[model samples]
Target: MLSKRRLTGTISNYRFYAQSLATASNSLLGELNDWETDGDLTTKIGKSLAAIITSLDALQHFKAEMKRSPLMPKRRNADAA
Candidate 1:
């Protein structure tokens, strides 16, 4: 079983990672605006950015669920083996 302190640290790390990714994404958008490019390249960049944001969102959701649920990673039963 994971201790409460360790679980809290893990969740905090996830939150920090998500926030950093969001900030980087915003920076990418700003650079794209400055580039003023159009068509396929722009579409590709937009799609990639969207994918990254979606992944971060999923991580955040997972972290929230972990906090709410009683579930934790199953430990090995040495005696049963």
Candidate 2:
């Protein structure tokens, strides 16, 4: 069985990865918006954007679930420090 500290570290890494992916997706969408395209290409871009948005939504849900998991460490309040 994994130690609590190790397990927490792994979960933290996963959360970081998810955040990185979301940031990258947002950057890609911004770049895509700056591009000028024809009707066919526009349709393809729309589909791609939809897929990216769906993936981001799923990641957000997963993060929320992780926050609710008992194994995850509780966050400290900065003001209480």
Error of 2 at 31 (Å): 10
Q: Would you give me the overall lDDT of model 1?
A: 0.68
Clashing pairs in 2: none
TM-score of each: 0.48, 0.50
Tell me how far the alpha carbon of residue 28 in candidate 2 is from the true structure, in angstroms, after superposition.
7.0
- In model 1, the runs with Cα more than 4 Å from the true position are 37-81
lDDT of 1 by residue, 1-81 (tens): 446786787678777767767776776676577675554556657765775787588687766668565556656889999
Clashes of each: 0, 0
Highest lDDT model number: 1
